[model samples]
Target: MPNPSSTSSPYPLPEEIRNLLADVETFVADTLRGENLSKKAKEKRESLIKKIKDVKSIYLQDFQDKGDTEDGEEYDDPFAGPPDTVSLASERYDKDDEAHSEGNQFPPIAAQDLPFVLKAGYLEKRRKDHSFLGFEWQKRWCALSKTVFYYYGSDKDKQQKGEFSIDGYNVRMNNTLRKDGKKDCCFEISAPDKRIYQFTAASPKDAEEWVQQLNFVLQDMGSDVIPEDDDERGELYDDVDHPLPTSSPPASSQPIDDEIYEELPEEEEDNVPAQVEEQRKMNQD
Candidate 1:
């Protein structure tokens, strides 16, 4: 017979058949427990026992067949497939090759004749040691294609303006000024010291190096590059007014009036000493 808890049957027994089977099972149980029967009469109970066993066997076979059908269906399904593999080494190599190729594509710029012009306005804005001068060198290279311009000025007025432009192997000072005094017409390369550095060819590729060297010199002098405009100067000063917050509350928001001391009553002051004396007496007792 199939276990009652087993889920092997695809269908249920008819109500009439179920009732008949239940009655047979009850009769078999009763027969086994009855003590009034003689030994010979108990042996004749085999026919009734066989009928109960047959009913259970039929139900059990049906349940087993249903279970087998379900298992077969699961195996026949075709959606399942194998997992995939990935190549970590190939991916890493591709990334490395890309980085190496990018590095080789660009050439370096030379220190001499850095091709660009530094705007006096821009240099003043940076106001940090070497940064202003470095920007000046970078600007010079950016402005003049492949030609480099050299500047001459005192440490105080690095933006005071005089520079010379060097293109290819040729070197010349730019000293032309506008008649209206509005702008400088020429670039300055050399100073009154007459110290002449050898003229060299520079490409856009060499801009970073030239700027670095110029910045180094400015840092050694211990001066910052300040902005040339009044508005830019004001911006630095404005920052001082708005400092970062701390744990203390803002002074303006505090309740100053609440902390002011009020006059005390004479009666209350007189009673204070009497109360203290009474408390001392109680403690002594």
Candidate 2:
């Protein structure tokens, strides 16, 4: 590694730049030393003043050393060093193109061309009971696609800690049952097994749009159905559970890209209560 003392001065130091820097430095210094500062101020003024002075030191040294450049162009910028860009020889690029053209008859198709593939990507979702420390409604990045849903602690995380199927589910806008301020932009998803998942978007429109888009995907897959547990959901879900389609997609893959959101196989992890089990048994009559 090169020594920091050997660094070249950054440039384009014209008369205008010098005057502007001087004005800024003077203004900052005056503001720092002013006696008429607000009495209600709670910030550490000393720390801010030191930070400004440190930045000014870097700029001042750079300007003084660069004051003598003949050309108007910037020279020896600290932010930009030697240009690493290089162009391949024309003959090499031409030969590579020729080889590439001799390979395939048809160009590869992209996955987004499939039918009913409305929208799919990672989105911020907040669980109802995720009150970490003292903050309410902690957000998690969730991956949503036509058939699968995944959530992780962060974007670059190695493995997802929790996930659920998007198929055979119902979605609806959040209702203010828990009395948690304005929940107009919150929504809930209820799986076939009666497990409810809640998410809040940045706005009511965003939440509604997500619910509508999810409902559309479910309809296409044949899992669109109205939910039948309004009272049960009111007791458990803080938001609301809207009716959804009751269809399931086919087993075959579609034209859409497989790399988008990897589909999760249907999981059967329902732990229905004894009352619900008895009700189902009675419904069979």
User: Candidate 1's error at 23, in angstroms?
Assistant: 1.6
Which 10-residue window of candidate 2 scores lowest in summed lDDT?
Answer: 82-91
**lDDT by residue for model 1 (187-270), tens:** 223334433322111322232344433444434334466323578778767777777667886676555534433324656788
- List model 2 lDDT by residue over 1-285, tens digit each: 233345433654464544444334333333233345664442555554444344434454554344433222222111223210001111122224334433222232223332344544444344333212211232444556446555443455444435555777898887662234336767788866545767767667777888887886677678456443568667666443544556766545553435344433212224346668899999998
Query: With candidate 1 superimposed using the best TM-score fit, by how many Å does residue 199's alpha carbon deviate from the native?
Result: 99
Estimated TM-score per prediction? 0.17, 0.34
Give model 2's TM-score versus the native structure.
0.34
Model 1 per-residue lDDT at 268: 75
lDDT of each: 0.34, 0.46
Off by over 4 Å in 1: 1-12, 61-285
